[model samples]
Target chain A: MKNQELPSLNYVFLLKQTTLEQPFISIKMMIVQQILFVIISIVAFYLFAKKASEIRRNILLGRDEDLTDQSEKRWKNMVLLAFGQKKMFKKPIPAILHLFVYVGFVLINIEVLEILIDGVFGTHRALEAPLGSFYHFLIGFFEILAVLTLIAVISFLVRRNILKVKRLSMAELDGFPKRDANTILYIEVVLMSMLLIMNASEGAIMLQEGTGNGFLISTMLAPAIVGLSPESLHLIERICWWGHILGIYAFLNYLPYSKHFHILLAFPNAYYQRLTPQAEMRNMKDIQNEVLYMMQPELAPPPPADGSQPATSAFGAKDVKDLSWKNLMDAYACTECGRCTDACPANTTGKKLSPRKIMMATRDRLEEVGTNINQNKTFVEDGKTLLHDYISVEELRACTTCQACVEACPVSISPLDIIAQLRRNLVMEESNAPQEWNLMFSNIETNMAPWKFSPDERDAWIHS
Target chain B: MLEVKSMAEFMASGESPDVLFWVGCAGSFDQRAQKITKAFVQILNKVGVSFAILGKEEMCTGDPARRAGNEFLFQMMAYNNIQVLNGYNVKKIITTCPHCFNVIKNEYPALGGNYEVIHHTVFLQQLINDGKLVLKDGGAFKGTKITYHDSCYLGRGNGVYEAPREVLQALDVELVEMKSCRSKGLCCGAGGAQMFKEEEAGTTRVNFKRTDEAIETGANIIASNCPFCTTMLVDGVKNREKEEAIKVMDIAEMVALSLKDQ
Candidate 1:
């Protein structure tokens, strides 16, 4: 009987030793996992930066422009457009919901700091002791925001997929854009769920320790999983915690490849927006130089030799490289919200003109150019231009230069400028203007009016 | 009515005028728009302001040419007009057309043609404010329902909304507003040189869409400030077979009808 009791006592001792050693083994494992994720996060950042700078270099391949005027006004515009979202309020319902997601997205990122600290040092709830009671409040606040983000993202998904908003379902948004939007929504939903699961599991462990503070969401969720043993709760918590951080790192890298790149580009895009009056059209300097040479030769420089000008140096944009850097940046900065197209008179009137398409085509052509450079270390002369290859002449001519697109843009992007530049190419370089336009041009050249009548006969109506 | 003098006539007589009337191409050519020209001239005569017309020497302001993307022609016409105006040492200028107003006031300064350019609506508003042009009590348009169509040039292009509205107010008419007005105004479908070119295939005509908004106001008269807008609105009214019911008139024509002399 004494020998049997001794064996059972030894068994109890063995169980206690294993239970005590569990944390030590996990600490070692967590350190290894932490190093792995850090390496992965670094690699993801490197790739994202590489892709982002490639885009920047490609945009700079375009002609140099001076959008640097009115710095004070530009800053104010950025504040109003990007931060204040002044134009989003035009549709109040979506604006309010989007505000929730936007705010949640920014605020929730703060937790990533605590996560990195805990992951790196193998500390459990490292901030809780330092933060005291505030940690519970912080977690509760994050939980609330997580729930809101989930709701907002789901609603957005429904709007795009279920409600089938016409703006989202347009022909241009059919392929990658449609999938890209859904991917971002799904990512948000997953991330938000992981956060809740992590908190809930943590709450279960705290309850077993008899120290659960009963934070709102986690406390509510804890009761359902409270029956689970401590070991299972710890495993669940560890899995969710790792998944949430990994998902965030992946999302950071995915932005440069997505239309959601606007999340990072919108501020700078608004900061560099054209500061001139809405009705004003930019005067082409090359045309202005030629006009000065013709009208006031004394103020103009001597004309260059016929062959001195490069064959590639056309009057206006024939390709992405002929556009201003700001124009390319505008394309990269498009939120794919379709507000410009919705407000466009040409589009509204059933014309084959959509400002949204113009931006997307610009981005697509830029990507093509970028790929060409990546393969050849320079442009390979693809025999395709943004002009006839991507955007047609019919679409260019259909624009009224009404500036509705510019006005309607929540980010202050001006698709009209792109239209005007392309139109300039057609008129000045290609001489490909519509027949009526050519007739009117000649009429003005000879008669100083868009009519066949002589200038002297202009006053005929007064006599009649 | 006072006879209007030409800049050539003013130059020959060595008589300087207070203002130069830049009667634009449509005002000088379109028969309907010509009446607006004459009406505005009569107001100048009634106000006894020393105004002169460029007449035969006046070239187009090159608004339509520039808008049509013909920079060469625009510069040629602009330079010619600028040369003539500067040669006369002209200072203050007013025009009945918003196209002329926009180009001369905004585009001309860039091409070395700087002058005090004013739209006829703003000028007429000033004249009324100065007590130079008096409105008659119970005039032709008095108590009549009028909806002012915001021309792209005068309203959106130049941000001159109050002047036209104020002019309508002086006529003692019931000034009703369309749903889209002021900076949010719809185009008359004649801007950007569309007046001279056929419109591209579209779901609906912008002018007719705008006219429908005006018609929705239940106003019998559609007041306009620009010749292009007047033409488009007139065509819009005719298309809806509301021509007999709705009279499309320039603000100048409306003011002329409400003048003490008329």
Candidate 2:
């Protein structure tokens, strides 16, 4: 108390005043609520994780011949990229603020564990006395960080609300949720602030109640609680605590279905990043050899019809299933953070392609894949492919494959490979590629240069 | 790890040469680029270097084609070039165009194309290092505050920013830099096959922005390496109406100055 610390949280005093704090929560209801929390969480998390794994296997229908080499390399880079927050670091303000929120949220999980242990195990005074100092210090620091993060999020909202929301309509593209989306984000932030204040208020109530075991901030709020009776103070604590836990519950459940789905995808996606630098163009085998192989289709054996192709099919993703496994995981890890959209030359230049949309498209395709998995169907089984239906040919062709998205991706997803594979499928398999590309292909074949020169003229540019 | 044992290993399989030079597409194809290349060759020959040519056997190094989203075309051209080079076992590579140099040095390896690649300016600088190359008194470039454009392929692709600058620096001329140069250098609208494809429809091409940055320095001589950059910037100069005051030159063209007295 003499430490000149901010008012400490008098958790012990608040808990001891069972008459007021425990109101409406009979022992029977408490037991039922605890059971529901445990059971529901276990089932939801299990289903989500299991569904993710199942969808992954179902989608990874294509394979590169050098799968081992490509995969191992991608995995290492993805790890570095996600854990290091490399892309976030590219934009300083949002990145640092996000880092604070991210770390604060993660660290706050420890406080949740403490609450559960004390609440469920009757270890109320157990950790409090022994880890009191350490616990108090962390809670204090986390509250301060939480407050800062709240402020950052509030400004983010105002910027989006008072400023960016209007600009959204004038942007070259559409589909951005105008007011409704911003409203939800604002609500999320508001809820977070409420949780912090409630926790801090509880701390104050304890300190003012003369609970020597409280932390500085909570204890400081103790004086503020002096005006209220024990009953009212206790009531406030229960309301805040329940609201905080429910907020956490709702957030976890809703997150899997959100654009920030990268939260779940990031870990696995990082472990499966593209091993190759996007700038280094990979060389396919001899053109004549490919033509010769294509001519002799009898010699080439298609794999068993389990929907899996032979790994050596130099033919790139002939369909959605042809994408590498990591590509599927990458769709999940995409935070939709818009760094790629911001950096995209095509998008910035008013081209139809937004790298952000491409990532989102991939995610939606995966969701479609998830839907299709139980039905034992392929992405292209119905002549209505997920990619063709989701992303337009113009958007696909618009990509220069400059690896801007690859470079911009914080999770290290190789969108270029996916796009290139789609191109391969369009050009080679179906002849459904854009007319311009077909002409360009013909020009290169006939004239060696797309400039429509003679084959002999290829070398003429050398001496001109 | 990488070394130029001798040019004779590829050219004649044992005959030593005073210098090994690489003549790239721009040098061989484009009229102005050919002029610069020949001038560079003339200077090197005058310095007692016995050089050889790949002649008509060379196709596009696949730099432009591949960057433009046509990897299929690139591989075809690359495969042919690799076979041709290994046929002569061509070693000790040198190039006039930084784009060609980059492909020959870096991009080729993935496609089985590897050689001891150096841009012409670096080779010229080496000749200076060995005290074999000497500058002619072309005088001080008219005190033109020259701004250097770090070609994406040359500077960022292979980290060859200094060699070209060294050639400029040796001339005792003014050397101003673009705001965005070197690793962070903006593209001149030629990268990623952009030279072939229509540019993203915008008020100005990215290269136009780059050229403007260079022009901001008020330097008359805008230096570049890759022909794509040179072509774009030269047009930028004319369209911007700075042509009367500004000119674009390659490092090879500049190095030819050292041999001007030849």
Candidate 3:
């Protein structure tokens, strides 16, 4: 192989010659394989993108409001929340490990571009022909990353399945969540192992040429497989190579259905995050306008005119569509790390509220609605909503609006906002507030205070 | 301090005070919060800063109604208060309660009530910095061990952990910090109208956990900026039967106690 020139196009001849003796695949078979690969890849990509757009459309089912102000702040938040993973550092150990997986997986994907090219073009290490020396270093770096990713993935598996970390084993993580997490970890481990084994087997076959030192892990393992015949080495390398690329395609399609959708949505989610101070709740703009009209009639701006009958609505959110698109995006972007619930006072103190569940319920309801649209070609009445059907009034009321979940979210997703919106539905739309809240509400209406004191008595404390 | 005039009184006299004191519902009706109001008023008087209260014209800032999800009631109360404040041509205002300060400073502007609203801690800190309101010698709080509890509204709600501490620093007290202070501070379980309702079933009340964090600092006094926090911490101290050992006081009360008597 060292004596032979390794041009990019030579792969067809080289691979065929290696398998010439016993049941060599014909040109027709090779063409069939190439066509099948392209079809599978195209189908995978099309389905993945279709599902992603479904989620986007579902999010836009929300009422329109401009969150486009302060582009600079949004960009900074994206960098800090998603890329920098600032909030993840609260738990230093897990964060460091997660960083390994995050950085490794992200950086390692650069090599996948080449693998994808190789699969499409029927070429073997085509980049090596273009850039000779750096290609070795590139593969070497990718190999090292693969090893780190492997270690991290194994640690995650142990933490979830064996060590049983409490946060991962929480009640909400049962069923598909538990399996989904483990499945991704398993996929990662297998993909990483196949990469190393493919490299090692290729290096073993190339040992006759005295060149097997490029990949760190593979170079070390090549000696262990030195006794194996070159044909067997080639066979093993081909299987590993095919398995790795196919697994990656499968993973890509799987991501949209999993909480791993955060992998793609995190950037956009962080960019659309609420930039105002965490303590500042967004005022219901309709009510704000109404207040302005009541307080300063002459200065009140006219309501927007679309020349259509204005729809009368009870104030605040009642359905998923009443939520802002950014909030819906937050639901889709949740990584389901349980960090928010861990930090939430309500959840930690054994209240019925779980911030993670709030996000999950939102995503679930959105997904259900999306499926309805897809099936019926329009949203049919499911007679279910995100508020009372998925998330309960008790859960909504239990939140203290402490902003702890907002602060603790690694990706800057604010479940507190979602809770507030749901609570708004309960009080404004359904009149389902606790009796105490109703009392306080009446007091404010009658006396301009949460207490039952008269306005004249407000001055009594001044004299006291 | 004894003759606190209303904004209406000042207007009728052709005298506009520098700032309108928005005595919130608690400061006007809750007995414990009234002490905070008086202490803050006394400090203003000692500094010779002419300020007037909203008095009978002052309504609740509608913070509780808004938080409790009653938008209509909140808007009704908010519009009425905004009308009164804007009518007075009030350019600057201050309040002792964090809920009032937060609502007036942050929430009110959207409803056409914009003013330079400062919380009393920040106002007091400014007063001291401006060479008004000097401390007497080492001041009354000298040699006293004080731990400051960060109110959700005053601390995390408004990013004002420093102003209260700065006001307390002037008293020359030994300031011991709780484990979770500043941005990481726990709520006193009183924000978002949680004060008006029974807490949802839980293993522990938020105030109990927060007060326990404060007491763990082993300070004799738990100083706070918000009246709600003061009440919650006071109750926490009582619950632990350490009322004799631990005293809960507002930042204004601490400053007023240490003021130089005229």
Q: Please name the candidate that would achieve the greatest TM-score relative to the true structure.
A: 3
Per-residue lDDT tens digits for candidate 2, residues B1-262, read 1122223344557654443455655565566666666667666666666666665555567665555445566667777778777767667777877667767777777655667887877887787778687776755463658888876666655666687787787776789888766655666766655566566455556656767888888887887776778888887787788888888987667666546464
Off by over 4 Å in 3: A1-33, A291-309, B1-3
Measured against the true chain A, the candidates' chain A TM-scores are: 0.92, 0.78, 0.91
- Docking quality band of candidate 1, CAPRI definitions: medium
**What DockQ, on C-alphas, does every prediction get?**
0.54, 0.26, 0.67
Total clashes in model 1, counting residue pairs 3 or more apart in sequence or in different chains: 2
Relative to the true structure, candidate 2 reaches a TM of 0.80
Q: Locate the minimum summed-lDDT window of 10 residues in model 2 chain A.
A: A165-174
- Against the true structure, candidate 1 has what lDDT? 0.84
Task: TM-score each candidate.
Answer: 0.91, 0.80, 0.93
Ranking by DockQ: 3, 1, 2
* Candidate 1 lDDT tens digits, A1-464: 99879987886677567679977877778879878877877887798889999989988988888888889998998999899889889778789888888888888889988888887777777899999999999989999999988988999999999999888889889899999999998999999999998999888888889986466787789989888767678778889988998898789888888899888888998998876556666666566667777666798755476748533367678899999999999999997899888867678788888999999999999999999999999899999999999999888877776776787788778888888778877887788888888888888777777778888787676557
Better model by DockQ: candidate 1 vs candidate 2: 1
Reference contact recovery of candidate 3 = 0.63
